[model samples]
Target: MAVEEILERLTRGVRDMDEELAAEAAQDALANQMPALTAINDGLVRGMNEAGRLYETQEYFVPELLLCSDAMYAGLGILSPHIQRAEEESRAKVVIGVMQGDTHDIGKNLVKLMLEVDGFEVFDLGRDVTPADFVAKVKETGAELLGMSTLMSTTMDAMGVAIRMLQQEGLREQTTVMIGGGPISQAFADLIGADGYAENATGAVREARRLLASRGAAVR
Candidate 1:
């Protein structure tokens, strides 16, 4: 099959939530000597982006989105190890998590996948992460970027608390903080003294790159 055809198959597999097809297409891409990054960004990510749009329009619900993510990750599992070390080198370290009291992590997981595809070394803290846990991870990893998300308005305050804790620990200056989720906005990010905000997973990757670049950090 042509490379374009293989990539299309990969995209279709994820968009259609077919894990087997996605894995098959991913293997084909590798056999064809296609760049793993290209397969991920142009294939899997594009499929996930379409799935996201479908969810936004209410054409797909959480179950469908989760299936799509599974298919995408199936492809990613095949492609990730093939990424060139040269591309991985100098990538910024990022710490990401959902705030305490918020168990909705679909958004956070999508952002984490996008960030990984963009070559960021991400340490996922998972959902319901406490402020102290986030601070501890940041300190332990010496991560240059910190990303937090919450789907609940009530738990939004935890983002600010995390930021304040980072400041108290003297880690705020070295970390570029970014926030997003259903209840999050640029205003909230600004209000919490965050370095950046994104409205969606793709935007999260863009914002992360821009924030890191502004800090003289190398981002591929």
Candidate 2:
């Protein structure tokens, strides 16, 4: 099959929430000698982005979104291993997690996938992560970027607490912090002294890249 045809299949598979089709198309892309990165960014990511848009418009809900993510991951499992690793050492490192007191992680998971596709070395701390754990991971990894999210207004304060911990550890100057989730806004980010704020997963990737570039750090 043509590269375009295979890529479209991959995108359609994810957008339609068909995991088997996505996996098959991913295999086809590899068999056709297509670059793994191209297949991911141009195919799976595009599909996931569309799914996100659908969710934003209320055409799809959390369940549909999760199914699409499953399809995307099905493809990713096949293509991710094929990504070139020669420049791995130069990629920026990111530590991401949902704040304490919140179990919502769909948004965080999407952001994580986008960051990985964009060539960042990601360490995901999963849901209900404590402020101390966030700081500890950043200190351990010497990560340049720290991303935190929360769906509840009550849990939002934990993001600020995490930032404070980073500051107390003297890691604030070296880490670029980004905050997001349903209750988060740019004003909140500024109030919490975060380096940036992202309203969505795509915005998260853009903000991450821009923040890293502004710091003269390698991105992509």
Candidate 3:
């Protein structure tokens, strides 16, 4: 297929939530020597952006968004390994997790997916992550950003704890903190001394970019 045709197939596959088709299109793009970044940015990410728009307009709900992300990842799995090391290495590293005591991860997972599609190298810490673990991961990875999520109001304090841990570890200045999930608010984020707050996956991606830019961190 022509590059345009391949890109169209990749885009349509994500828009239609067809995992197999997205993967196939991604393979075709790779076989055609299309740049992996081009296929991702021009195809998968474009489709995910449309899905985000629909979600904001209420035309697509959580379920639909999840499916769309599935398609996006399907393409990503096929293309990401083929990306040039220099290009891949340029992506900013980000640490993400669900706060301790909270088992919910749907929101966190979505944010991770969006960040990956946007070219951020994400280290997902999974659910019920401890403040020490978050701090440890940041120290170990030297990540530029930390994103946390929790669905339970009771578990929200863990976000604050994690921040304090970062400060205590002397990593606070080096890392930008962002929080989200249904129970989290901008006011709450500010109160906890978080660097940023986002209500959803789309907003998280935007906030992450803004935070990185503010820190003079290079973002591809």
Which candidate leads in TM-score? 3
Better of 1 and 3 by TM-score: 3
Q: How accurate locally is residue 103 in candidate 3, as Cα lDDT from 0 to 100?
A: 94
Q: Candidate 2, residue 107: CA error in Å?
A: 1.9
Ranking by lDDT: 3, 2, 1
Residue runs of model 3 more than 4 Å from their true location after superposition? none
> Between candidates 2 and 3, which one is better according to lDDT?
3
Where does model 2 exceed 4 Å of error? 52-61, 87-89
Counting clashing residue pairs in each candidate, in order, gives 0, 0, 0
Candidate 1 least-lDDT 10 residues: 83-92
For model 3, residues 91-141, the per-residue Cα lDDT tens digits are: 899999998999999889989988988889999999999989988999999
Give candidate 1 misplaced runs (Cα > 4 Å).
33-35, 49-64, 84-87
lDDT of 3 at 62: 89
Candidate No. with top lDDT: 3
lDDT of 2 by residue, 1-220 (tens): 8999999999999989999999999999999999888898899988887887787788988788789889999999999899876624477999999999999998899889778766688999999999999999999999999999999999999898999999999999999999999999999999989999988777798899899899998675
